[model samples]
Target: LILMLVMVGLLSLILGMGLPTTANYIVVSSLMAGVVVELGAQSGLIVPLIAVHLFVFYFGIMADVTPPVGLASFAAAAVSGGDAIKTGFVAFFYSLRTVALPFVFIFNTDLLLIDVTWVQGILVFITASIAILVFTAGTMGWFLTKSRVYESVALVLIAFMLFRPDFVMDRIQPPFQQVEPSAFTEALGNAAEGDEIRLVVSGPDFDTGDNKETTLVLSVGAGSGEERLANFGLLLLPEDGVVKMDEPSFGSAFSDSLSSFDFYGDDPVQIASVQAPSNQMAKEWVFIPALIFLAFIAFLQRARISRQGVPA
Candidate 1:
């Protein structure tokens, strides 16, 4: 996976050389995302998948401003008569946020729309946006007031809370108690047919009534035992009625009528109860804290530069 991602990043960077960020993302995503899907990861993780591509795309664009082929830097230097390297560095620093934003959304599902609840999602959006603002302000040293190191840190922490998914709060509350056997029995009885005889048995053993089992008994009265036995097997009880035969008997009158009488078979008695998740809650949870982290980093960078008396 790591090797594949590296190759994808390299390809995206190579292809992104002169393309706009959005165009570069589209091109690489179209070309490489299929390969990832084939590898068995969910398609929903596309945000992160595309983020890697975009990271390479950003670097590819930066290559133009980095050194030898610094076209944008050269153009600016020629116009302003400034040093090309310095101009390139300035541009790179100013656009740092662009490179970081993708990572933020990629790591945080709330930002990327993974298993997010409406109220929680909204809260995440609001907090992350504020964190971004704080980060930008700290970086530029141009918010309502110049941000102190501690203030920047606080802002970052707040952003982290906003972007991180609140698992405790986001958890889906189960709407009902576990299904009881009695309930299952009631449901089965309600669904039983008129001719069916319901026997409640216990345990995993079907032969011994120790285990719970529901049996449907059918009786055939009109045919010879041999004829009935030919059509359907019979269960016989001893003359004393204390013991029942383990296997079907062919000589009984009941066996004779077995052909004329319809048997429900072993299907209903073996019905297994099903348990389903509640429809009221979500199956997944997404954390929004990532956006805050991005904002925090951006703000930290800005603050660090400011402390050095440098323009962010």
Candidate 2:
């Protein structure tokens, strides 16, 4: 999965080189977006559509300034009377500082503005912009003033936290508890109200004529596991050590959403893994503290620069 995603990004970057902006996006998105979707499906990764598109598109744009066939690098080199290859490498180094954004947003779709409210969008925008600015400052070793080695490292960490606060929170508190497939019934039966149960399933996708893996997040509400699943438009029958889908409710969310995938095949699907949600401290709890630390670093830098009488 890791290799395939990297290849997708590299392919998009190469395709974008030497192409006009409009044609670059059109060609890369048309050719490479489907590769990401297919690879993501095979890997059981629920990457958002917009995230995949942007991931390829962003790297493609970056390629225009990257090495070998970098048009931007050549143009800049022409104006500077410098080596095009050398300028391309330098441009590539700077672009690497921002390339992490696409990867972070790929894992955390919240950054893509998917399903975000106006207020949430504003907050994400503000935090993400600040995080990227701090990230650039650290990568370039300059902010309010030239950053010390340790300060630059801290700034990078702070930027990552601001961009994905859940990373730290998840490390401190696990997000899910793995449940044995054999004990799935007992776990489901005893699940708490409003809890979410994640099931990883794999089976043949007839539509694509390929084996595919997908994840289903089922809500275990104030009743039996089956009942809550039914609410989400799924019907299951588990007996004699086998689980089968009886049938999805007509016109239901499950049926509508997965109509094309056909995860609920005629044969019993393979249960790859099961995970139950764990109540953990919200990521916001970490975000606020990280933001404060970042502000403190900026303050220290500004004060140091002021003492040194550096020009603003």
Candidate 3:
């Protein structure tokens, strides 16, 4: 599957090289995107649909600036009297500035605008765009003012922090605090009506027999027992001191969550583990320092530009 991902990405890149924009998108996405989606899940990657499509599309578009047969570079060379190969290399270098974005969205679906609240969407857009600009400034060695080498490096690091502040905090403090399965009964019993119960479970895949892990976010009801579980679309019947999955309501959250894991007829899946969501430090927390650094650079650059009598 890892091989498949690499192959898909490379193939998409190659196919994108000479193809026109719309056709390039249609061809690569139609051919390779599905392979990534299917093989990725089987490989335990579970990348978002939006991310995969964008990933292929990005590489396809990148082909235009790539070496050897780069049409964009040829056009630029024709206009600027430069070698086409050199122009292609230069264009490719510029394109590298935005390459990290696809990988970012692949790991963090928030950047793809998936499952984000309206407020979060706005914040993400603002912070991400600003971070990209900062990164560009660092790479180009210019901002509002010309940047020293060390200052450019610092700006780049600051940009990365603003782009994915949670990355560092996660290493320092893991986001999830494990919950014991033994305490599940108490937790479920005590949960108020309409509350969400998040459970992470791992079991053998019913189809492939491979062990796979998935999270089940079940909703609690106003009542308790089988009735409570039923509210979340689960029907469990006990037979001879053993709990069994009786019937999962079609189109219900229970069935939807359960579909990700393997379940056999009338057999209870052992709960290998559990986790209650823990709030992590907000990514925006790092944005403050990043913005301050950006402002400092801007101030220095503005002063330099003024000294040169450049137009404001």
Candidate 4:
């Protein structure tokens, strides 16, 4: 997923080069947003459509600071009486930290404050502030004082952990547990409104008659199981001890892509897995180790500064 995001970001940067802000957003959102959404789903990571669009838009705007054809850099250079290309290079260098924000928010939507509680919002604000500061210090090679090579690396790692505690938590405990497809009805019934249920569908392709499988994340709404499924354009029924997929309704989420699946062929379309979110301990525990490591770096930097008699 990260590799795909990086590739899309670079592509957006290129496609948006030398374009005005409005034109840049239009081009990148039109060309790159769908790629992220489709690729993310194929990779079993269902990114929100808005998030994908914002991700591309972020990188698209960054083109102005990139080299060779940096309009923003030229304007800045004209105002500062500096060389345009050099200014572009320096701007791009500084932008590396900013580049990390889109990736961070992609996985940790709390940074965007989506679906967060008041307390959670405060915590997110605090951690995000600290993370950004530590990240900036790491990238700039300074923290309290001059940072050693190792200290800078540690600071960056600490910042990442702070920004995304779930990355560490996931290693300890997976976020979602795979449930049998037979339990889809039960899972859907138990799911709270607005929850997402990941479903894997597989069957023979309608056009090529080849077998294919893909994951779909359907949003649960306030309704019965069948009604909820209808929201995503899915209709599943139990027949002959196997769940069979019926034709999707018009103008629903599954109407377009699910059409390729041969629902009534020899090998019928069926749900392969139903992934339900697992209950786990708060991810904030990872913050302890990250803060400890950050303190260690600060202590090391402080000692170095003292020994060198540098004002900090």
Which candidate's lDDT is highest?
A: 4
lDDT tens readout by residue for model 1, 1-312: 445555654565566555655775677667765554333131212334544454445556665665544678788999999998799788767766444454455445566555667876686677667757755665554544456676666655544444443432335464222334334323223332322222221123333323232222223223443443244343433333222223335564333322222233342122222122233343223333444455555566677777777665
What is candidate 2's lDDT per residue for 185-304, written digit by digit as tens?
567878887677877766566586465666766667666755666677765566675554544678876564345455456655455677888878877688788888988998998898
Please, what are the lDDT tens digits per residue for candidate 4 over residues 91-169? Answer: 9888887678999768888888888999999999999999999999998899999888988999999999999999899
* All candidates: TM-score: 0.41, 0.76, 0.69, 0.88
Q: In angstroms, how far off is 41's CA in candidate 4? A: 1.0
Candidate ranking under lDDT, highest first, comes to 4, 2, 3, 1
Give the clash count for each candidate. Answer: 20, 0, 1, 0
Measured with C-alpha atoms, the lDDT of residue 114 in candidate 4 is 84
Model 2 RMSD in Å is: 4.5
Clash pairs for candidate 2: none
Candidate 1 lands at a TM-score of: 0.41
- Judged by lDDT relative to the true structure, which candidate is superior, 2 or 4? 4
- Evaluate all candidate structures by whole-model CA lDDT and list the values in order: 0.47, 0.79, 0.73, 0.86
What local lDDT does model 2 show for residue 228? 63
Model 4 lDDT, residue 172, Cα: 95
The 10 consecutive residues of candidate 4 with the worst lDDT sum are 38-47
